[model samples]
Target: MGGVAQSFGPFSVRRLMDGVFEAPVADLRHLGGSGPLAAFTAGVAGSTLPMDVNCFLLRSAEGLTLVDAGCGSAWGARYGHARAAMKEAGIDPGDIDRVLITHLHGDHALGLIESESAYFPRAEIVIPARDFAFFTDEAQRAAVPAARRGGFDVAARVRRAYGDRIRLVGEGAVTEGIVLLPLPGHTPGQAGYRLGSGENALVIIGDALHLAEAQAADPDLGFIYDVDPVIAGDTRRRLLGEAAEQGWALAGGHLPGILRARATEGRFVLTAV
Candidate 1:
């Protein structure tokens, strides 16, 4: 897959394309059956929607940090690109100093392990405490209502691979100039990382808004994967609004192309960065 790169102050932000998958249009029920949604789908005129699976690498003189790993081969054949994409960008997994995970969803966290080992062997893994508790606690795993227990099972595999190297973080600067902004509701601990010092900053919002075309058109519309649709909608609106207001570059795990966001006429718009 081809890679996309951008500079954020002294840090280099690079996009690693994992792969793409087709999602049914009905999956976007949050958009409702009328208004702009009808028009939006009519524009595409397709039964299946194309969604990109992406991960980003943040590099600086002091350290190398990765924001979410792509879906591993375990999820499906369409994913599993972290190692290859890094190699394409001339980066070795061992050279990464830290991995800032937004959440523990399979597509975002399964790449933590490769071939039954820690993919980035030397990097410190950072994750949200809420997610760590929800996905790793045996009691919580057992109570996860069956349908969602698969995530806990996969997370257990990751825990076994990374072991003591994992670090749980809250709302604050995780390292250097990168700060963790908790954007929950997609998952209890889903978050985004804020990087760069000034005007040239960017936020890698993992799964905050999967389809930029639809969500950017209407943030109130929620995806089926959201753990709490109401809260997820609020988080999406707030974060995207903040980004637009501050003129910050925005990126997402499932945005179709090189992602960036802006606001105009009371609506969020995305462009390739």
Candidate 2:
């Protein structure tokens, strides 16, 4: 969990560091090969990419809202420390009324359960409709590689625990100010939340670009975790263009910190905001 906090409109947001893991470079692929892109991927192949699993905690008059839950006890003791981080910050888990899931991946959804039950006793698990549909479909499990098939199990476990408490939605206003932005391809229904507007605006894009700098420079690169890599790249390109044009900042589950898109030469790069 992070001690730093930023304000967006009437909401105070905190990026809670849930866990950190090394993402293998081999998992990345170039949707379309470019000389520079191919070389970049090859250069990083033998190494691991360090990524942070972060969850955002938003506070407003509407109570507390959490964006994505860490992998609670899901991957064993190596992760799932976000709960303690929250407690350390004097946050009561029961106060969180909404746990907005970006996708059904373990780090994002499995935290909804603790001791084989809902972690937040009172929070409504708001999940993207498309993700809920696709991940839950046993038929769709075959769509992804066996290594990436874990989302199906994660989705089922979360669904079973949350049960009637789960709320499925497409792209729309989640509350008074927060809006869900449709960012598919990473998963069939990866959701990003837009907060505030303009220069001060912040968008919590979940795994849209696992490697912000690498992907920002070349939006065609995607992780093997992506169900539809092509669409994922498209979404990344669109979002980067939008952010650069709109002067908005982006935050993500794997992204280190808040970053803004800046067009350098003919390519775009992410600069810390």
Candidate 3:
């Protein structure tokens, strides 16, 4: 799969992971109503559905900041050739100055590792405080069902290796231009980032909206892995409304390209440009 690069105002965005499979549209009806199902079927076609799972690298005057790391070596069996895509983009793991993890999901955080060590040794790994607390707690891990326990394990290993370098940011400015907005419910402390100076801004909605068509058309739908479906749905609805009203550029963790169009009310169409 080929990666794409796009410019959103002052920030430069690039797709680090291009292809991944997701469930069919019919399966999405369980999430909410028929709107999402119809949008998914129409926008995404063909069997063996290959959707893009992107990691964005933002370059600013201060330094290079990565949004989410794609599937690491552990998930190679499923995603294949983890680091090759980033390498192709000319992003050296060592050159990354900061890594902002949207959540602790394996696919998003796993690629932080390189040669059995944390991938960005010189970079500070920023995570939401609530998510860090939940994922690192031993009791929480034991309480989760077996099927979801693997995620906790991955979180544990990341915490152990990068304890000192891990920085926690709540709903505020992590850096000068990057503001972390709490978008919770996808995971306990999942967040979206708003970049740029003022009214002209782009919201890096990390996993807050997974599939562009499904989410844009029906913001109430939830993905299967969503930790709190109700909250996720509500957040999605509110964010979509706000983004459309504000005319903000929206980017997502699993969206197909480096940048995707925000749907206008009633039209249900995407303008990628």
Candidate 4:
């Protein structure tokens, strides 16, 4: 409906498509803080404190799938427009069958709730095993710096709410035609997903690239939430290089646009087409 739905690839089976699940930027700014706000404002003129929180719904034969759930109801008070966006995309939360969580960050997983329960009741939540452990472990929670403690709490609540629906996966193909590429460092189990085959492939990179300017131009620019900056930078460089060389469409969890890929300048760039 409208311009929210777009398609790629020459055929249905091989086609990679995405729908925008728009949420408010205010919620994102509040959660991400001033640093993210400053970065967004500087990169995109007129950008204010909160940049819109947009999630993606990917279509495949297996059924409707979601990339990251935007900040759910808890944070909805400030940024609840995501639900309306989903409606605009014609996706009923109950209809989503699978949710691939890129990491345990609050902004990404917080939206998995509905009335104090898992929002996607029948959906199987896919997460990295390493990240699952990291957020669920009490010892690890205590180890996080005071500033990051809130994130740990949010992640824990998600785990408790989803419980059995959570399915931990690793670096490899978890489903036919879909591959989970491990891109750790942003979190213990941060990951990216590759869909389709040959030249028709698309990769959904979650939180691996926060700001297009810093990530696309300088993969080395690390974010405050990156658990391992060095490793995260390396992963970004490697993924960016591979996507560019192979001519695969790339999508970032936080980046604007539905699909983006690096141009062939041997430098990181984003192609909205």
Best by TM-score: 2
What are the clashing pairs of model 1? none
Question: How do the residues 117-152 of candidate 3 rate in per-residue lDDT, one tens digit apiece?
Answer: 787778899888888888888898888767676668
Top of the candidates by lDDT: 2
Better of 3 and 4 by TM-score: 3
Ranking by TM-score: 2, 1, 3, 4
What is the model-wide C-alpha lDDT for candidate 3?
0.72
Local lDDT at 57 for model 4: 71
Candidate 1 per-residue lDDT, tens place, 1-273, comes to 646668887787888777786878866656345575666667767788888888888879868888988876767777786667778768887889988889998788888887778988799999988877777778877765676676687678878999999999999888888888889888888888888744587888888888786788688776567777788888988988888777777888887555567888888888876
Task: Give lDDT: candidate 3, residue 98.
Answer: 90
Estimate the TM-score for candidate 2. Answer: 0.95
Off by over 4 Å in 2: 34-37
- The deviation in Å at residue 158 for candidate 1 is 1.5
TM-score of each: 0.90, 0.95, 0.85, 0.80
- Select the stronger candidate by TM-score from 1 and 2: 2
Which RMSD values do the candidates have, in order? 2.3, 1.6, 3.2, 5.5
Candidates ranked, most accurate by lDDT first = 2, 1, 3, 4
| Regions of model 1 farther than 4 Å from truth | 31-44, 138-145
The digit string of per-residue lDDT tens for model 2 on 1-273 reads 674889887789888888888887766678666665568866674578889998899888888999999898878877888888889888877978899999989888788988788889989999999999998887888766788898888888888888899999889888877889999989989999988889878899998889888889889887788888899989999999898998989999899988889888988999987
Report residue 142 deviation for candidate 3 (angstroms). 3.3
